[model samples]
Target chain A: MEPYPYTVNPFVHQDRFWYPFVSPFDPCPPIRAKRYVVPPNQFLGFQPPNLLQFPPAQALMKGTLWPALFSPYKKTGKVEIKDP
Target chain B: MWVYEKKLQYPVRVSQCNPTLAKYLIEQYGGADGELAAALRYLNQRYTLPDKVTGLLTDIGTEEFAHLEMIATMVYKLTKDATPEQLKEAGLGDHYADHDRALFYHNAAGNPFTATYIQAKGDPIADLYEDIAAEEKARATYQWLIDISDDPDINDGLKFLREREVVHSQRFREAVELIKEYNEQKNFF
Candidate 1:
């Protein structure tokens, strides 16, 4: 007997994963191009302040990840998982 | 042009914050060799990069952003419950002493953020080599973080970040080789 016409396609499956409210496909919001333009007048050689010199203990952990805080698999990569 | 929908590759959950851990992870945010600096460096350099190095810089620069998010999440979580006692337990009392209960936004060691970490030099060969070094440094830092972390989940994330750094370093090295080959054929010297 033929299958019901309304039956879901077994070959096609929807990802059961949850997605974020924000979509990644959205184009990066446009901002004034000058926002990123670096000024040429500034002395270029000025060393970016090196903060690594202080002992690691001195560093503050203001915004790091917590062990049980989030699920690493909420989002998956498009790339296939091949044995490396 | 073919367009593939883009999305966050990982889900970030805002759990209870631990101020102490936040203070330490801040190192990755604005530290001298932190992910923030790395992202800014590669993104800025991409503009001046030759075609051969463009993809390399973009890929690496984007990855730095993920690292930045990871670090930021860590800090936020650690500080959610910023109690003096908890802070002490997390080994963040020293940071709290100076900052006085305020979680300052700076690099790992409370250093102010600056842009001097990156250099374009207008030379692809030189920049590509620098890129490789940058990746190696980041990889080393992630490895160090993993070594210090006692949490299994945190360690897993750190391990992944460390591996990514290695892959990026390899890519930059390849980009260097490509530039050399191009120059050799063009100059024929």
Candidate 2:
């Protein structure tokens, strides 16, 4: 059966302002949040509690080897294997 | 032969605006090594660049226009619907804090624009390296802005712009590689 509920991770905050893994930011106080600049009428969907809580469908693995199977260079290109 | 586009990607409308952010963005608009300078630098540099570098310079220069648009949008949104009381509360009620009625001609903040940022050294290597540095700096500033903002709208726009900087940096790196190739070929003769 399909999963009942979906969840999204909060850690995945992607934006111009948020530099992942390397930003020296000290969060402003909650007062700043109250007065935060709310954009006029932009709406995004709600975040789920736990992203990837359920496993991906079994059929997803079927095409995972597409690059190896249909690669243009798989047969024509030379593969040089050298001992290190 | 550039003409004005009479629209904004995202409306610059904000109920409560912070002047501080406006000022920083203005620095980006006209500040040394900022977008305006970057655009002008690359476009002008194209004239003297080798044929190999011509296309790369033109592409990078054109992309600067998009950066300019993004900064202008941020400034506009920060200034739109802003009230004097709100500006004062944000500690931005200075002689230069004229929101609600300004055109797209000032710095990221509300300061009078300056042309000090764009430098064309005439040396291709120097200018190309400078452009690479400028891309990294702009990316850093975008990171700083994202860190302070929780607004998803701004975040969405900001993320795209940041990724663009990364792409531009790669292009500049490629340009450098091409230049090195030309120099090596010349010396080999």
Candidate 3:
């Protein structure tokens, strides 16, 4: 039997958009929606009890046992690879 | 005492031999925020830390060595087949002249790895914060390396490494909280 079998909080967001107020006298153009991350740890002030876990194979592949902690990163720059 | 694990923590299969990528990969292998620095820093800190979190440090430190091995595997596979001329063309001429395909502890800019890269302060908060910053920096480094490299296999390895940083950083943050709670308990006495 799978432990903590139900997928938990997978839809909970990790990335947050911080919209800086554009000043009229600013030298550069208004840059909106600067994407930033609120990593899993921040959401979890401390690791909570009975956390859902990935299966052994999936855990090794995801780089963590807890599914909440697996944050796939997308690089922010010239090359645009698809974000997970 | 640590037992030798023959298999890599994560599989590292290189699709092509790109010495340029190998050069970039060395930064993580030996640079300031690299795995070696991380392993040494955490392991050294473990001895002085409160007993509860000491095990965490040891566990993560040991894991960093696995990460270090995985990186070495990638670098070795990438550069193993490259000719001397090919290595030179990839901006490793200076390295080739000195080491000749042998791995040296140096950063992308050719700075040798030094003790200054790792710190073991007695203060738990300070050490944990340093660890947190190191993990974030390594995460960013992997992101940039992944950005510039085109090889899918190398990127797969880099992606795994990058995600590990996230896990480590999270653990360190939790450790900080754990230490703080311990301090509060100590104050009660």
Candidate 4:
């Protein structure tokens, strides 16, 4: 089953990608790009005054009153980590 | 002087019995990263913090207790009707033998809850940073719980809990900024 059928807009900027310095001599094939999380809160070192907020009902559903602060984590991609 | 609301902060719906899932959910119930640890950690830190920070801690700490109750509700509902054999099969045999359906403060692996799970550094900056980390950890826990959970009804509750962790983390971050500003002003004077 597809855990998340719909996609979130990448423009939302909730997450970021980084290109690791892969060694050509390494045994395993180096992956091109990797996704790393920079949660919404990370951008806001200090919350601004009077940010836009989700409606009360939607707020409860989203788990945050402010839309900017809500980082949706869907169960789709499997986490992959390589041992150094 | 806190008001007791009979209803849950979020509607918890556990559709069917699955003790295996319940066993995994116990990590958030009595685990080091669970709601009880969060509630106690923040509440204990509230006393020595700046007045503004203290109020925020109180608010978040109290909310964590409510979250704990919701976790407890789910655990209880999951295990309420299971037989000893069923529970034993679900890896809760020791829990059943010792506690017998009674909710014990222990992690998924059965390590009992201890005050050591929580920390109160007394300094606002340290405590708020710790609080933010704690909230993020709890959010990750909820995400893993949701990933493992196949029950939609249970997932709904877990989703709510996870989101609360996000909100709390942000609030603590803002509080950290506020406390820093407060300290700067104090130094200027």
**Top of the candidates by TM-score:** 3
Interface RMSD of 3: 1.5
Clashes per prediction?
36, 14, 0, 0
Residue B79 of model 2, lDDT score:
60
Which tens-of-lDDT digit does each residue in B44-148 have in candidate 1? Answer: 888887787787688778778877777666666657657778876777777668775554547666667877776778788788778777776775566556545
**Which one wins by lDDT: 2 or 3?**
3
The numbered model that scores best in lDDT is 3
In order, the Cα lDDT scores of the candidates are: 0.57, 0.55, 0.84, 0.83
Kindly report the docking quality category of candidate 1.
incorrect
Regions more than 4 Å wrong, model 1: A1-84, B1-8, B11-19, B88-105, B183-189
Write the residue-wise lDDT of candidate 2 on B49-151 in tens digits. Answer: 7678888888778778866887777766776666767656655566335544354455545456555666678777887888888877776666566666645
Rate residue B166 of model 4 by lDDT.
77
DockQ of each: 0.02, 0.03, 0.54, 0.53
Which digits, one per residue and each the tens of the lDDT, describe model 3 over residues A1-84? Answer: 222235645335555455577789999876554665556765666778898989999888878889777777665553232222
Winner by DockQ: 3
TM-scores for every candidate against the unseen true structure:
0.58, 0.59, 0.85, 0.84
Model 4 docking tier (incorrect/acceptable/medium/high)? medium
> Is candidate 2 or 3 superior in TM-score?
3
Question: What interface RMSD does each of the candidate structures achieve?
Answer: 13.8, 20.1, 1.5, 1.4
